[model samples]
Target: MSCQHAPSSDGNPTEADSLVIKVVETSAAGKQLSELTKFTASGADVVEITIKPNETYQTITGFGGSFTEASAYLLNQLSPDNRQRILEAYFGDAGARYSLTRTHINS
Candidate 1:
């Protein structure tokens, strides 16, 4: 697979702060397995993955926080199919939470 660095909004090539993989030769299943293993082993302690269609950049927002936690939060808010896909890709698990904490207060 060939990897290319993404450009910033200003059209300048940005320094890569994270590893980006471009799948070329691998089978879809193999690619998924490899990607999952690599991300899991990155020693990031916490990872946030934003899954979206290649045509759009509007999906989950990575707070640059924990992937597990962020994913859980997303599951609570997203459709079942989307939640399941993300869970399977990241944690290899699928379970939804009904209760979530909100920081807002009534004035």
Candidate 2:
């Protein structure tokens, strides 16, 4: 995912801004997909997707998951080595790469 934001001429962020976002798909075939279409005054049914890597409209903070009491209990029951493996599986770069997480209070 990519986003692009246009800044105001006065060097200040304004409520009225221009933003364009595009989705980048990863595939084993190494295929890149992007399309551009112009809309007519009468309106068109066709839809087009445009990809611009240099353009960014939004910033992603993080990806995360929640931890439940049941899950926590199960995890704590595991051995230290097993616990390390589970943590790495979720937070590791080769895994889901979860950057944010939450645990319910008193759960």
Candidate 3:
């Protein structure tokens, strides 16, 4: 089914409330959340959705990178073993290299 939009129950019900969503898909065949580009759905099977856009209660805002001191502080707050595990996870070959510096740290 193809959905265009739906009426927002929080607001009033109307054609405008119908949520016209941009459809995308991810597949093992290399479709990484790609839009359903040229496909169109019609007939009674066409679906609709509604959402209240302004209802978000909270959000996280930050830059993409560079919170170095913050990282050091949180890490130091952990116990010795916990901190070591965290450090290993960040710097180990099989883990994410979240370490900005090549040098190792001791706490």
Best by TM-score: 2
Residue 18's C-alpha lDDT in candidate 1? 44
- Give the per-residue lDDT digits (tens) of candidate 1, residues 26-95: 4655554243322222565754444333567566532222335554566789888987676555444343
TM-score of 3: 0.30
Tens digits of per-residue lDDT for model 3, 9-93: 7656765543444668889999887878544345886755435577787774521234366677898899999998977776766
- Reference-based lDDT, each prediction: 0.47, 0.75, 0.62
Ranking by lDDT: 2, 3, 1
> Alpha carbon lDDT of residue 71, candidate 1?
43
lDDT of prediction 1: 0.47
Candidate 3, poorest ten consecutive residues by summed lDDT: 98-107
Number of the top candidate by lDDT?
A: 2
On the 0 to 100 scale, the lDDT of residue 25 in model 3 is 86
Worst ten in a row by lDDT for model 1? 98-107
TM-score for each predicted model, relative to the true structure: 0.22, 0.49, 0.30
**Which portions of model 1 miss their true places by more than 4 Å?**
1-65, 68-71, 93-107
Instruction: Give the CA lDDT, 0 to 100, for residue 10 in model 3.
Output: 61
